[model samples]
Target: MSAPSDAKHPPPLEHAASWYAASANAAPARPALSADVSCDVCVVGAGFTGLSSALHLAEKGLDVVVLEAARVGYGASGRNGGQIVNSYSRDMDVIEDKYGAETARALGDMAFEGNRIIRERIASYDIECDLRERNLFAACNARQLQGLKAHQALWRRYGHDQLELLEGKAYRREIGSDRYTGALVDHSGGHLHPLNLVLGEAAAFESLGGKIFEHSPVVSLVHGQTVTVKTADGRVHADRVVMAGNAYMSGVMPALEGKSMPCGTQIIATEPLGEDLARTLLPNDIAVEDCNYLLDYYRLTRDNRLIYGGGVNYGNAGPANIEAVIRPKMLKTFPQLKDVRVDYAWSGNFLMTLNRLPQFGVINDNVYYAQGYSGHGVTCTHLAGRLISEVMTGRDERFDAFAGLPHLPFPGGRLLRVPLSAMGAWYYETRDKLGI
Candidate 1:
């Protein structure tokens, strides 16, 4: 494997060549914005957050237009591990300790709401993204296993009672490996084809009269009573604007630049393991993530390919060879797959914040934004959309709960933030190895 480097960033205006993209449901090319358009709301970025917000707003009878830098699900929303992990990057216990019980209670109440929203969309719109149930959190050591126990209790306190604990080798029934000391299973947590999910949502949005312009990257935002979102070839004027660009919104909004950083992660899919061999790797067909700060996550795709991913590349740099970086991690988890050939390897970026919580608030009162999911975008992005839509519709209580949480910039600023975060990750990784 090549040493990590900071010189690379994902090319704009296209989806990375990934297994998700290859197997994705057929999606038509949406025309780029070629002329000025007016709408009640113009959403920047057509990933999960943008599409979810657009669909919700359209359901509320608002005219919405969405602009995308590339195709739908082109960013992390399309290429993530695809596990529907519940809650935020930093869990509720951290929010409670740092923020307060009231703030935590409000945030916790809606932690799993995103999963429900996804299911509703899939059922209501007939989105076929290979929806499956159950997500397992594996603990590589006893210390991490204790963390899972505490996590289970914490979720139970939030009225989430769908957890089941497996001690010692009991988790092997679900994970099919000896690397884990224990695991906590969430019956409601799940996985699906992320790209197809976003594409399906985009279609559902269009079905509700919402318009999307792919390949239309926002160049500037002029905010006022009426907001103007400008692209190179076209512009959009709307009563309000939603900046759901997340990691890919670079250079569009100066105000949000230093608030978060983009970090990349690698994923690889092994050639079809076949149903029998796939079952040997993940016995219960459930998605799994370990408890380390920089954790590994894997699952069996609908077609029986083993989708494995781990390792972080701060500063959004693509590794020299994604397969080289991740193949070892996968083999470490399931050494029996030593001979399996990898069919796909790719990387994607998610926005990260200093405090590991999502950043939510408005810019100049009318321009709204939700980003900095900090590696937990799968569920949180959908929640962000609901909160953004609710606030736009005049209900602000839930959204305020998140916006009230302070998001500090990295201590070292842009020049040093990447290395600083990488050092922190290394420290945590060491502790994980030592079972501290």
Candidate 2:
């Protein structure tokens, strides 16, 4: 009824949806799991990765079933800044350094393919998700602009030559903001109504007769020749199980707990400004992100509201005053919007591996798990799902290329890792401020 209901009460994920949710044209919720069920495959966590995996496996005619703790898109998939930027948060050279040149090339291909999958799915499903294909990487100053220039070479070397440099008159004409000294027009990356896309894919999976169980959280996992997933209401005994629980994963897989840590990122959406004013504030309607490591990303919705996202906390508890803490940051970038009121603010945790690389691997052979998207989950999840299904079906080369990358646990362990990581963040924040 009110603007902030989705964030203030933070409706139970299964019952609540975000702005994207309000616009979704999806089928009603899948029935809850009521009793023990058997299938050829059981995928845990029904976000984009889980749903995508289920879709591919089902298309192969495998009797696959998906189990979700909350409603679909309850995690980062629904709550992200929605910018589908092309590069992995981790460096491509890291893959080359740890794996090999070919492996790095393959990884780049996967990231590119991930973007393709999003576009192909939208076209095939005829789903309406307010999709857009424009992005701006706004640089705060000359120093940041240099980084973008170097990145341009890296992207070019990988055969991605779509980005354009924007500065001065050109930059202001594009974004209508003087906060950025330069900007990168990200043709390869863009934004979308994330939850709608996730739900739409979930519907596509079911249209093919794949089963989905919502409000059914996986409590424990048994991995082996035959994988078993135990949920609160039922257990799915299957030939294979996939752990797509990106950030909210807990006892379901102890081995993965320390492989990455979750950091809370919060977002607020402004009340719908009329289209005319919204256009004036952001002439291009392109998704905008700054050059800072801890950055602010904002964009306009189809209905003409400002969806602003930034601010991070390693702890699960949100900022003491999310609205108060985040609003100032928004103003620093767009001081002209001092009178703009925040309509809603909600937060979610995103997993970050030590190297900022995504963690994808098998636990006990048949029980596969992939997490640690490091804020690139929107597109990477699609690729993760496709690779998981390929491996399950005996196509190992592509999957193993990614699985071979080493993922070490956080040094201090989960109990102490949060604060340890927070302190590390403080050191970086201090550097970003002093222009180190």
Candidate 3:
């Protein structure tokens, strides 16, 4: 199948105009690729996966170079919900059911590793990204509450004990909203300023002697004993190549085209709600995501703005007005915010695999890739980076565990995958509405 058209997936030159961009810390723009270069490893994409992989590899004293099509964190890494959600989009129990006990055990051990890595990076590197330490999975009804209870138990079996179940008035104490029937709090899972965190990681990688080049999109890649990656004006010949570009990869490699579909999700940031109101909206300042299949995830920014996100476009065409798409959902969670003004609105895409599990493997024994985090990327991407680094360094057990998981292409291939996904999502949304 042909790759998605350039008109539909244009090259990104800068960060999206969002609250994160406005509050981003200043950094010098590194020059793009102007001459041929050779490195021990060539990484494509500068988001969480690429930066983390580069940092790990550089710390091991390997020569590494990262090429970004746009600015650092230019893709979903900078435009995500910022929630440090632990584990895969599909729960561990589901993984165990489908893949068996041993597979689930291996994945479960690394489930919370990403969260730990994030915290370690923040403290060790002094990344000031407004890190918080609480995330709540809110249930819309009693049935969903039961699911959360089962979820807590399942996670506990996996050695995750930092969880608390709350209901009735107790739930209101954590979240001031009455829309949720109950909540499962995971103290280990939290939120952060995603863009700043990624930028800080990039800086850390550079400090470890890594090289990064922005506006150096990979035009073509030839895999062999030594992979060659070409751009408009320059090329990279490396012992290994890592494709970390998720949805924004834009068909740089035809092999990954049908493996995942680019789906757009949007977020809106409300104007400062004042300290008193902000505290009332989120009493403990915990991040939240509902139990619905097509869920809403939100959290309060350090500056007291409500960063609410929801709604997905499987067709990859973003809504004309992001505010219009997200504002109502925000108001539904907090009707008192009817008069609050929206300060920023933006959309970004995430690569969605048919099974909603991340895909990791090596191609031609020299080119490696990790993508399709589904919607749980904030944490999983970090885990992916660590795993990829391990594989590159010859410690391949953990990486092989994940790489062995089966990933199927979306039904109907590239042409009809989007509409098929939309139809499936609509069916689940209906089930969510009926509380089925």
Candidate 4:
């Protein structure tokens, strides 16, 4: 572990536009990386991590250039469930059971800080993304209910006493659904407009004079004292580079492409239900997630639309008709939504490592990367960016904790991991049916 330094971490520059492009706070697009450029750092992927690294480093007056294949926020950072959740995918108790209480405490603390990282950014940066402070951790079954109970107790041991375990009417009141038997109300976690958040940070990064190139996909990198980042139309000479592409950097970096598998998550936005029905649907406007591996995450959009996310698939192929695939899932959760029209339906990929914990670290000290937040990218990516910035300068303590967690690459390599995962998913679904 090294001390946090003041170096900028830049990736390959990209040039283009996106949905975020349509709604970015103040996007003064920069010219493409047309010629060989020299910079203190180059960042790849204008998503949370890359934009954030650029922001922090440029704040320190470093010459930073960010590269993205598409426009910023085109990847999982913009498409996630907007759940600013704590704890890694393995859960706190699993960490405690396998690693011990001390390590579990560190894990919980990091996750808790992941929430704080977001809150601090919203306030400090004045980001307006329908920010809220309600998070309902739900259990779909009694068995899951017990696990949440244990999870609450373990988190409490870490001094998070404010976490409230709600059941019965309390759970019903916290969320509008009786389908969930119990829930943990994490007042600290919340929901937000993710694309806006990423775009806002990009604005802040530019404010500090960071250079950005859109539609600039990094085709190759030559590593040495100074990293040579080559994009199709341009090149960058920098002391350090950061890969923050997450699920979108397909084939850009050979070593990272297969490390994390991408799974498609679908969402259905109901036509405006009005305050009356929206209040009945989710009175508290709390973001919710179930305990099932394939979970349903939903929240009321600022305009009173039920933004329901569900049906995760382990293939690159998106559901041809997202409305058709998600409407049934929504109706199952809220039969009252039978008459509700799904105004918008979309699906996006979320990368998940086999270990279930997020992957963050310096593939090389001068070259850092962060990904595999599972479905918890909103807040985790913020933390990832911060830590990667720290690693870029010299700090390495916090980054090491996450990097220390073991991550196993999918077996059968590139050719068959998807099929294997799909088969395993079917088995889990079958078990769900058999009550196993």
Candidate 5:
């Protein structure tokens, strides 16, 4: 139940205490890297990006080694809302408007590819992460409902047609809450147990002759033709390096230091409500997220527990009491859960960029990294891994589309970035309240 002492450079540890941790399948501790190793590619962090990249590269007959700061799926990859939401944090319309139609077309083509990869990996590897179908985007006000309409239209323009609009009492067919004015159901989007998925992917990667050293936090990278990735106990000399560490990484690549900031979100799981009540709460048993600037997302766990999560801390700082911060929000949506007991509460961090899109680029022609997934790491991270692998294998067209996008350092640097971003969030949140 111990928290990570250093958020940026978390020490080697077990998974955070949460519902996921309690129900996680058995996984033995991986050995720490104690001897110098050499490989075709050395990936940092065993979360989604690293595992996905390692698995893809391993399948391509390359020798891949993954080093984890903690256990597999230990970061946001393991702890997110588990919804397979598509698209980047900044959707395609914004990309097209800001970067141009060519960039938008390139990204739109792969908007849903990440979730597709998730399902494919699950079926191909027989991963049991409680995969489910359909996800709903709920709207609390007329403005947000109209926004959902535009969102559906925007997604359709990108060729994703598995959507249906629901309004009035129809919302109850999906979510029991009366808070939503309408909802958009994405038949293609879904949810699953995140930790199990990544763990299974890691096992699948190892099956392909990939090696992962847990408790091996990379302390520094000596970049050259052959990158030397140094950890506390060992070093990995490789032809290429994948810095897939995301938010938990710091001080390794100074060039990447100020471009993104880590932010925390909290989640709480209520005691099992049993099948009937659980079904009543989420009649269709799909994940649902509100359409707010700072949104709330929840889903019924396989065990029937309501897992609700929301709220953000821009500075990567977590609330002193997670349940205290989130319980009221849960009650505001589902007051019927007045007497329900919270069985678990936990917090996790995700890297955020100024533009809200993921930052993908290579360092020194060999050190490739894809981070700053903002709040959309679940699907994007998987896609990033595939793209990183593809680019390394000489297929850079799709990779360049993402890498070509611009990412800038936060305007106020580390010290003021948190407060500045907080102010922006507050402004948007106020607009949400005013139903703008």
Candidate 6:
């Protein structure tokens, strides 16, 4: 399979105009590929996954070259809610029920590995990404609250003890909102400045002798004893290739197109609400995401701005006015914020698999790919990079565990998958409304 090269294809270049970009730390624009290069490993996509893979491989003294379609973290990695929620989009109970106890156990152990990797990178490299250490899953109705209870019990059985359940006024204390009936807090989970974190990781990778090329989209990938990845003006011949491009890969691999559909999620940042107001809105300053099918996730920025995100477009097209679509949800969650001014609004696409599980596997003998993190890519992507590196280093047990998970394609073909998924989501959304 080859990357798309057409006039309509967006060029791999600048970062999106997001709140993250406005306050991003200084990082020079990397040069695009202009000449052929050879490496032990070639990584496509410089988001969290690619950067993590490159950093890990370079740490092992491997020759690594990463080719990015755009600037580092130009996709969902840079534009997500930045919540470090452990586990997949689907809960462990669902996985256990569908796959079995052993499979669920293996995945459960890996669920928190990504969070550990992120914290280690931040401390080891001293990357300043406003790293925090708490996240809450708020429940709006009794059914959702019951699910949280079951979720906490399930995690406890898996030896996870950092969970704390809050109810009534205690829930209100944790999150300064009257909307939640109860909340489950994960002390191990947290949030960070996602774009800055990715950029810092890229720098760390480069410092370890890993090469990175920005604005170099993979036009074709030729698999063989030594895979060849070609860009518009250059090529990379490597012992192995890793396809880390999620939703933004276009048609790079025709086989991967149907396994997941790109879904658009939008976010809006409110103007600085002052320290007092911010404190009042989020008393503990921890990230929060509801338990609904179409969830609303949010957190307070370092500058005291409310970074609220929700509203998914299953068709992959962004709303005409992102602020308009998100503002109502924010107002519903925190009525006092109705008068707050929106400072920035943006949208990005995440790969949503049919079963809501990430897709990870090898394309051939040496070409590997991992995608379809749903909306949980921030942490899972880091884990993916580690898994890929481990697999390359002759450690395939953990990698195989993820690779064994089944990933089904959408019911309809690519042309109809978007609308079909949208209709399915509507049904679930209706069920959530009915509290069923």
Q: Where does candidate 2 have its weakest 10-residue lDDT segment? A: 2-11
- The global C-alpha lDDT for each of the candidates, from Candidate 1 onward, is 0.91, 0.80, 0.91, 0.77, 0.92, 0.90
Please report, as a residue range, the 10-residue window in candidate 6 with the lowest summed lDDT: 2-11
Better of 4 and 6 by lDDT: 6
Top model by lDDT, which number? 5
lDDT of 6 by residue, 1-436 (tens): 6444577355446787889999899998888888999999999999998899999999998999999988899999998898998888887889999999998999998888898999999999889998888999999888999999999998888778899999666888777888888999999999999999999999999888889999888999988999999988899999999999899898779888878888999999999999998988889999999988899999999999999999689856789999989999999889999889999999999999888999989977799999899999988999999999999999999999889998887888888887887887899888888888
Regions of candidate 5 where Cα sits further than 4 Å from its true position: 1-11
Clashing pairs in 5: none
Model 4: residues with Cα > 4 Å off, grouped in runs: 1-26, 99-103, 433-436
**Candidate 1 Cα outliers beyond 4 Å, as residue runs:** 1-12
Candidate 4 — what's its lDDT? 0.77
Candidate 3, 146-239: lDDT as tens digits:
9999999999998999999997668998888889889999998899999999999999999888899997888899878899999877999999
Per-model TM against the reference: 0.97, 0.94, 0.97, 0.91, 0.97, 0.97
Of the two candidates 5 and 6, the one with more favorable lDDT, higher being better, is: 5
- lDDT accuracy of residue 10 in candidate 4: 42
Q: Roughly what TM-score does model 5 have, to 2 decimal places? A: 0.97
Candidate 4 residue-wise lDDT, 148-252, digit = tens: 788888778777776888775678886676687688888888888788888778777877778788867788889888999998668999999888888877776
lDDT of 6 at 364: 77
Query: How much is the lDDT of residue 436 in candidate 6?
Result: 87
Show the lowest summed lDDT stretch of 10 residues, model 4: 13-22
Task: Tell me the number of clashing residue pairs for each predicted model.
Answer: 0, 0, 0, 22, 0, 0
At residue 284, give the lDDT of candidate 6.
Answer: 90
